[model samples]
Target chain A: MKQQRDSIPELVWNGNISVEIHQKENSLTYLANLPRHSYFAQILEDLKRLFAPKVALEECWLSSGKASIKWHWPVGVLYDLLSQEDPESATSVPVLWHLVFHVGSFPSSLVVPMGSMETFRTCFFNALKESDYVRNGSSSLVIALSKPETDTYWNSLLNHDFYDYRPIATKLFTSKSRIIPLKIYLGADAPIVQSSASLGYTLGQVLHKQLPRLFPSAVMYSLLKPVLHGIVLPSTVSTDIMNRDFCYPDGFLHIVLIPIST
Target chain B: MASSINAVEDQLSKTLESLQTEEKSSSLQEKIDEIISSYNEKENRKVNLRFKAIGRTPLLRKNVFAINASHRFDKVIRFLKKELGFKPDSSLLLYVNYCFAPAPDEIIGNLYDNFSVDGYLLIYYCVNVAFG
Candidate 1:
């Protein structure tokens, strides 16, 4: 008797991004008394310098057992940074830093599937291609040349006289892990709600809304939930949350939130 | 008294001789030969038998063996060894339902009797190797 074969493996991403800003002089006064504030302020300054005057900076936090943040500066800013001839600009250049942050006691010897790498490369290149400014410039021509041949293409892009992109610095920090728990913290000026039911209901609204938009063919709730919950969150976030506990049978890494304390 | 005993013994010996002659008249070997010849003729007219092996393992087994005809057995074996750490000395077992058979050493011209699926040749190996 013949048996049915299994489905192909799929790669997924999960994470979130947020942006905040403060007046430079006021931030300096506040940072002088508070060390933590100063640290975060320096990070914001460094990000502003890299992204430059016209670029928007977004905060992204990713947790896949391990949490990490990656700040992708705008292509125009990167183009400017690379082309600057000033000595001060060269001196102020940040180190090309790449660190894989591991948190929550997850193992370090985790294996990431080759398929996931391909998926990431495709998504990243596609995103770059879609940028209008990038597509119109001489840099765009270089990017086009670097499109999807091999690792050599990426290496060449790095060495090209167009952009200075580097991986983010990451460090592991411990915090109380949340299960499927939903907590609503309202701001002081908000109106008192007659029902708290509506508050918790919208917690997953963004995820639910983005699911179909991100993956149009995701029809079944069962299939959608696992893939969405696993890949969507960590990839979107600025932090790199590399989970080492699970492996998908289809040869991909599994990223799922377990009930830590519920 | 002597004349009476001799007459009785002579009648018993004649009865035994008649039974032996009757048994020899029937021929059982001729009937068996005729049945075997007819069965052989029917099989020869209907079905064709073929055999295939990879790395000294016959293809017909309980496991669904994926086989490729586009490449030689040596090339396939070399690829497997290079990519998947499969050794030449690994035992290959083939079985189909309750029937089981192993490939012999001299398999160069053994009917080329295997099916191919999706450009892969499937053979049951006694040694466990990862398959994609």
Candidate 2:
């Protein structure tokens, strides 16, 4: 049991998303494995150095096809949201995320700005504050975090240090929260479905509550399944366990709904 | 193929529109139907929302809006922005209960069911990030 529990963090924290960022003007391609929990802004400084004289860090943004990647969401959430796969397809190879790095024409309406560390910190904290509120019914705990605690917490997420983030999160979470902070992504065109559910609820209960029509009660088998941390969850999976063990550093469970093979 | 992305969106919009169309005409059959239904749908009807301004956000002269139960929370945010004459670039945050901005896409009906009191979904709004 100890080994099983230990593997959860080891698997989640070390999970790398293989990213391929291509330059449009020249065919120069930059390939690297991005940490699933790190935001694009956290890694942009290093990426900008590769093309420093040509493109500044503040001027850079990544896109998949025409969709403007929301920089504030964790890189893994972006991958789950923007990409789709045929479950029946025979190939078992992992997905290599393709992104285009552009220097100009930042679409302010579509995506928020994250050019500076301050902007990134503010956005991250704002999201964290909201998630904490959903879990604890107040943002006081997050606001009360000391300067060093705040820095360590933020750096742990950016650095993908699950061990460093664990204790601080434990201090904040304190107990099994009544309401689980959760965001459900349906599709690209559809806006995200962010609804709070109780800690006692199972995956099936939450699904049926938020999306009853899609996950019809009359149907014996669900036509749709929820994916978290790049793995599909069983209907009986406990929301509390998932929240404690697999939730993102921001304290919210990011779930993606995809069609299951009938 | 039967359940494409558009299928779900269409169902959601139709449910919202149907609730709005028959908002006031809550027939006995509808009440019975809700009771008999296997799933506990929040309400097969609309919600009465009252907006309260906070932290320099302008108060709405006509604060109450009968929002459909199926509409997402983003609609409320967009409506507040347009009514308040906020520029497209401006930021407006909405909160419920006490001091947390629920995600913009939260369904209005769910918020009403979970947090409403006295049959009014009292939403608090701010022109800036006031809570944190």
Error of 1 at B91 (Å): 24
lDDT of each: 0.24, 0.70
> Candidate 2 chain B: minimum summed lDDT over ten consecutive residues — where?
B31-40
Model 2 residue A30 CA deviation (Å) reads 2.7
lDDT (Cα, tens digit) per residue for candidate 2, span B37-127: 3122333467889989887778888998898776767788888899999875578878775555655445676567545667898889887
lDDT of 1 by residue, A187-207 (tens): 111111101111122223423
The candidate that achieves the highest DockQ relative to the unseen native structure: 2
lDDT of 2 by residue, A1-262 (tens): 8786577756887777899887677557788888878788876766666644466566777789879876778888888777745334476478788888777798755665565787777767766777777777667788899989999998888777877888898777645467777787755544455667787777887777666655655223244567777777777887777876777877778987665643
lDDT of 2: 0.70
Best model number under lDDT: 2
lDDT of 2 at B28: 37
* Backbone atom clashes (below 3 Å) for every candidate: 27, 0
